[model samples]
Target chain A: MYVAVKGGERAIENAHRLLAHARRGDQSVPEVTLDQISEQLGLAVDRVMSEGSLYDRELAALAIKQARGDLIEAIFLVRAFRATLPRFGASEPVDTGAMRVQRRVSSTFKDIPGGQILGPTFDYTHRLLDPTLAEGFVPEAPATAEASTAATPRVTDILGRDGLIEPSPQAEAGASVGDLTREPLNFPADRDLRLQNLARGDEGFLLAMGYSTQRGYGRNHPFAGEIRFGEVEVEFAAEDVGFAVPLGAIELTECQMVNQFKGSATEAPSFTRGYGLAFGQSERKTMSMALVDRALRARELGEEALAPAQDEEFVMSHSDNVQATGFVEHLKLPHYVDFQSELGLLRKLRQEFAEANEAEPMKEAAE
Target chain B: MAVLAHAEAGEIAARLRSLALPDHQDLREPENGLVMLRGRIGGDGAPFNLGEATVSRAAVRLASGEVGFGYTLGRGREKARLIALCDALVQSRDFGAAVERDVIAPLREQLLARRRKVAAETAATKVDFYTMVRGEG
Candidate 1:
């Protein structure tokens, strides 16, 4: 018997109660602390921070716990929370040249200035799973050493010094660059706006687009100039102080790629650079970002842009994970109105076809 | 005929008001009450009639590079004139060039200053952030 079901509000409240119970499963087994998740599940925390566009590890850990380890859900929580925070002011751009080297590597050169550190990477690790780890074994700490004091010159800097790469232009100081969050995106965006959009873009989407470039779709021969992961001092300018003061330190992954450029008659041939930076150790995202960046510089490189990766509008417009996920998931919502309209159209078309077939013997014979 | 005469005069008066010109009472047409202003006469010269509009507009050019404009539903001549003046000032070459510094910056500063002043005046009755925390589950 089809009985009308009511009490939607009650059902929702009861479901919430059930969820609370489920989230606090096996209370006697002890709940996982935020610190444990932050430290132990460090990679997950990093991914959340990278995607969430927020640098709070503790909050990210809390979000993960609340979301029951759903990374996207955790990211959503962090992003939603970040929106509520009052904006005081923007921090001064960090001088990456003065970054205290931790893990730095270049795939192109055998040896560059500030020789590749390869710090805390799983690059050489074997894929074999350890049987001992199956029984919940504690990890052994690796021997620690002091950071290299030797100054690492940027790959682009070397090219710039030799007039091989395009010289970086200085942006006008104190220019009121419009905030992306506040304003809707318009076409023909400046480099600063593009970089800001890319920084907060979805990792997977960027990775795929970046991958396409490597797989011969707008392929640009890129050399990993330098990929570095380290803690950088974040500074903000104070009204009273003439100089900027250090606010705190944040862990960042930065990647710079040097690509070959063929100049045209009007322009001189020089090397170009693609840059990417993300919060925490996200090498894949950073590398993909760099490749995509290089592909986007096709016009500057004097290359015929024929690939999807080279299309700035297509890549930037579709790269947002939040918008993509929202629209994709919204299909699950009530679409009966559209479905009914489509159903009516299909029925009418079929009936018309049947009537036409019956009426025209000549058309039927031709078919 | 009387009703039509009254309506025509009312429409003319409205148009004159919209153009930011004074409606002369004595200059009303004898056959109809339509107020007429002579061309090239008053300060608000070259009056052109707008048959109908549900909106009123104002433009002002500020001293800064920012031009301020206001539009509201329904005809309000004075309000529209004030808004238009503000918009004209804002859109003026001198003020419009540095919109952020001249307009938005000052506006934000003024708002913040006013809020602070109000807060100070009501400091004794200030509500604590923790007040809501106690009520939360």
Candidate 2:
């Protein structure tokens, strides 16, 4: 009953040949280089890096090219390639406070310590397509204002000073958080694990889940306290090294959502926070992730878990697009024996019903 | 070290050519790997794994017994090896000052200049919002 189907080798080879032929459409046109993909199609590259959960731009670009611009497929390729590499060790927790701020904005306040920078944003751009872009239009650079003299502080820190926001829940002094890559994710995961899942989770999935909460699925109305995009240095301490060495800078997008938390019987009412951090300038991804992060905290904050976004198991399990795609696409594989058994049973049932009907008619006629 | 890791491979390699250096051998051959990146829960809370980054690290030992280690982000094995050699040279007595004058000082300057350029360009995009008074019109 469990037979292995073999010999699709010829068809598979033909399909691959067709694929390579199609991948390079219009052979006369100059082939898209890795530099072009990495530089021009940069946002696509960024998404792959963030969702793929790998931090190499060149690798992400290569994956994108190989997948023929299918971003999820590119992500799958990245995850596969990462499996073959050696893992050195975990880095020291990155310091977001000292980020060389390229873009920082606070939606809740009119003014923040570091003045708002709308660096290369699509926010204010009109939805209308620009025809000039196809012909390579370059705009003149804008004039500069003096850099901020005030000390840049994260909005959470400013709020935390007044005890306006509930202080971040402290882990035991030396408690280590779970890494999903190393250990299997069990239900009732900690905040750290949940954050890790969402950070690399599908952008569209989180966006939809977050949107559901806004439509009163499990409303935790959030105000975007701050969103910052910039680069920060990663420090890793190798074996036998007394000091941690800098492993170079990586860009990150971080979002902090401030949600109102009505107090419990003993605890005082204060604002709560949800945090999102991702690999590159994935602004939308980070914002959606932050929104969903707050919604999922219903159980922790003693609120009723009434929504899909609030369900930790549902969100965490389905958030990974790579796994979801695999399970869904596995339907294409052979299920011949299982289907044949079902077919046989249905046919037998129909035949028995027909025979019973014939005998009942004959008995009536004879009578 | 931060600047060195961030600097281009060509910039680093060219700096190494001028200095007359003793022979150095690899203690650890340059190898590509991944480093799991971690981030705090909030900006300042408990730590969590964010992702991993590609890195290449190498170590070199000079004839004089001075040991050097190099690490760089991404799969630049040659850059990692060159960095190791520079690290060892900077540690050694006779070549320390020369390596400092050639590599460290110049890379640091380049890093500063690049940072300044980004800061300036970002500053150009700084937004100053204005609100219309309803009664004025």
Candidate 3:
């Protein structure tokens, strides 16, 4: 006997209870603390912060725990939480130049003014797994005191001094440029929108796109002009005070790529630069981002624009992981109404074909 | 009652409030008929005709940006202006998501709850029971 099923509200409430139980698991087992997740799972926290666009590591750790370690879900949780936050005020741009250097490297120069501080990096480590870590392990601190007082000049800056690289344009002058978030993105977006999309884009997607450029898809002979990671002061101007105030500091990774460019008629030939900056120590993501940035600037670089990476409309429109994931997952929702319409059309088509075959008896007989 | 009515507004209004936009002063049935917007009419603003509409709107903004815009089904110019201001504030970077969640969502919920409460009360009072007894003629 078919009985009408009701109690959607009850089902939802019960399902939520079950989910809570599942998330908690066995009460006897030691619960993971937010501090442990933030400190121990530092990379995960960084990923969440970068994608979620929120700087709070503790909250990100909590989100990760609630999401069962699903980074995207954690990101979604952070984004949702962030959406509810009230508008405070806009912070003044952080000066990366004034960063308290922790890790700074330049591939273009062997020994720059401020000696290469290869702070804490996995670059020289072997990929072999350590069996001792199975029983748990703690890292010992290294004695370090080779500080340099010399200010580090950006590699691109040096190139700019010689008029080889393009000069960094003032962002304030570009304030009048329309924001993509405010208005729907039209074709041929400015560099700002493109950069914004790249900064918030899925790391894996950007990685693959950047890989394509290196493989001769949209080849631009590139060099890592400079890559720096450290703590930078974030300042904000209070309307009442009429002066900018420091709003603590944040760890950031900045990458600048120099590419060979020969200008055409409308523009002058100069060494073009691709820039990438993220919230934390995300070198690979930042480098890939820089490469993609350079590739996207093919038009401005006076090079023939030819690759999916160079297609501003395609890259900017499809780069958002949140939007991509939502549309992709939304297909899992009930689509019976649309399915019924499709089924009706298919049945009608099949019947028409059958009738047409029956009416062509002479043709069938001849065959 | 005013607070409840204010809460009935949606996340958009809350967002504006977070940006320091003024809370909506009051909501009243507009004397003028509502203008129901139809299909797109290019840059000629919203296309619409005369109709009855229940409109509510609020306003708020801080120094950094302008908050303007309002939504209404009726010809409530005040509501529309308030909503417009809210929209402007939401678009500003100064206003974060917290405003949308706290002020806006709660207000909307309250408004909806009030409407439902009023409707139920009116329905209960209008009840006219009729009992009939069957008998042999």
Q: Which structure among the candidates has the greatest lDDT?
A: 2
Q: After superposition, how far is residue A111 of candidate 3 from its true place, in Å?
A: 1.4
DockQ measured for candidate 1:
0.01
Against the native complex, each candidate's DockQ, computed on alpha carbons, is 0.01, 0.78, 0.01
Candidate ranking (lDDT, best to worst): 2, 3, 1
Native contact fraction, candidates in order: 0.00, 0.79, 0.00
* Model number with the top TM-score: 2
Error of 1 at B60 (Å): 42
Output DockQ, candidate 3.
0.01
The residue ranges of model 3 lying beyond 4 angstroms of the native Cα positions read A1-8, A172-174, A264-269, A362-367, B1-137
lDDT of 1 at A5: 40
Summarize candidate 3's per-residue lDDT along B1-137 as a digit string, tens digits: 12222322344444444455434332322222211111110101121110011222334443554543343322244544445454454565655354445555566676557545433333232213355678733
Clashes of each: 28, 0, 27
Model 1: per-residue Cα lDDT over A1-367, one tens digit each = 1234455788789999998889889999789999999888898888787777766677789999999898877888877876654443455565566665557777766567766676667888897888998767987744443334467776667667778877654446655544466678787655555555666678888989888988899988888887877655554443333444333356677788787776778778887777777778888888887788778778756689999988888888887677777778877756666777889999999999999888899777889
lDDT of 3 by residue, A46-157 (tens): 7787777666666778999999898888888877775654433445445666666666777887666665666667877897898877766776644434244578666776
